[model samples]
Target: MEYMNIINQIIILFLIIIVGFIAGKNKIISQEANVTLSKILLNITLPFLIISAFNFDFSKNMLKTAVTILIISIFVHGTLSIVSLILYKKQEEGVRKVLRFITIFSNCGFIGYPVAGSIYGSEGIFYAAIYNVGFNIFVWTIGILIFQSGNVKGKGLLRKVFINPGIISVSIGMTLFVFSIKLPYVISETIKLIGNITIPLSMIIVGVSLCGTSLKSAFKEGVYYYASFFRLVLVPLVVYFILTLFKFKGIYLGIPLIVSAMPAAANTVTFAQIYNGDVSCATKITIVSTIFSAITLPLMVLLLK
Candidate 1:
């Protein structure tokens, strides 16, 4: 029954994505509108979710767990960076940059929070938020550096890493947790309601992005397949087993695995656009990996659990 429930959760998420795909195909939502939705998600909804997640009472063990998970997450990204370097050593500069970025980062925030909440509720999201601290920090710093190939000359580097919504929420959330601060019940509840919009909105954005892409050409790149396999399957399984070997149990083990298993982040295209990388290649990998994740994620959970 637990296994069935997990599969159902994955199916429900895919169905939501399908809605966005249909909307995109029928011109129900234009690209400009979708961009607006994405901004709302990152700037507003996700931060609320992060704040609400910190409603848990503090404990020494919880702090320890948070730290451990943070370390593991950094290690996971660092190791993937090495793996990507080795695997794509001979590729062209643009392909190498995109491949390295996509392989190193996962869609931990947008997709991860909802799936973790469905399976493990608030506790799941709490850990997801912690894992995301590492993700947000690394992606902004190291990931951006890779994407731009160290083009940090004139960009507001500090603002990009420290002042972004994700890091801001993390900062606020951690402060609340450490101080045992509580918001008014009404305020917390309202934030909770707003945060709930994130899941469907994120999937819809992904689905809409998939609408006009040449799926065949996306798959035509043999390297895309190799990268997808590495992103969707190989790395997550290795991380899961490694965590298990260390005796990390329950949601601790599961949350990281799910986050690790998310397809290439949809932000790949955004980064490509910003850094003048291969936008088409980034889109193909992002869409194809996400489509494949609907199958791979549930299987990872079922087997790992």
Candidate 2:
């Protein structure tokens, strides 16, 4: 029954993503405008969401569980990230999306947290939050450096990572979590209001980002095959089997699979913009992979049981 509710919640989230895309398609919100919206969500809304999640005093019992989940979730997202990068290198260079895609995108933060939390409780959210922040930092610093080789301004990249609003918010959340401090109500609610906009806004931005692309190309250049197989099929399949071997179950396994399967990180586009790499190719990858996830994610979870 609890799992059913989670499933329903996830379906609703998917509907929201689609609705955002439709909204963009109809010009209810121009895709061009979403770039700024994305910035607002990342820099302002998301971080507050993180802090706002800490509204209650994290009791000692909840703290222990949170700590354990955080540590384990890191291992889950981090390990797969390394493996994905290696596999990414083996693929053709034209598909540069694979390179940036794996390192940066993990649905756990964006999709996984909300989906899993609605189902498994804060334990799911705790793990999902860690993967999103930790994965983002890794990609921004090490991952960006690797993919940034030919393009992007290499100088002061680390500086960019340090000041990233999302990154800064994670640092803030961790501080509050450790000291067990509750933020003031007014500020917390404000953050909550803004933060809640993340998923809906992100989905819409994704639709807007797809504005000028050719959907027909989804099957072109073998991009579709690689994007679908690597992200949806191959990566998660391997992760799924390996996780089962380790006997990790529930949100632990659930979070990684979802994260691993997320469409190429939106950050891929951000990195391309900053680094001047194959932005068009990266954008295409994001669009394609995200569309694929809508189909693949539900199927993957069905296989989980």
RMSD value for candidate 1: 1.6
Q: TM-score, each model?
A: 0.95, 0.84
Q: Write the per-residue lDDT of candidate 1 for residues 1-305, one digit (tens) a residue.
A: 28788788878988999999999999999888899999999999999988888888888888898888889888898888777767787788888889899899998877888888878878788889889878877788778888877778645876787788988887888888988998898988999899888889988988888886888888788888888999989989999989999998777788889999998876888998998888888888887888888888898888655
Q: Candidate 2: which stretches are off by over 4 Å?
A: 59-94, 97-100, 121-123, 150-155, 303-305
**Among all candidates shown, the one with the greatest lDDT:** 1
Q: lDDT per residue, candidate 2, 1-305, as tens digits? A: 24456567768877877777777778888756787787786777667766666554657865665565566556655665566555555555635544545444554555665666555554555556665666665666666655655344655666765777766776777678778777787876787787777766666666666664777774475645575567677777777888889887766677677666666666776666766567667766767777777778776776555
Worst lDDT run of 10 residues, candidate 1, spans 153-162
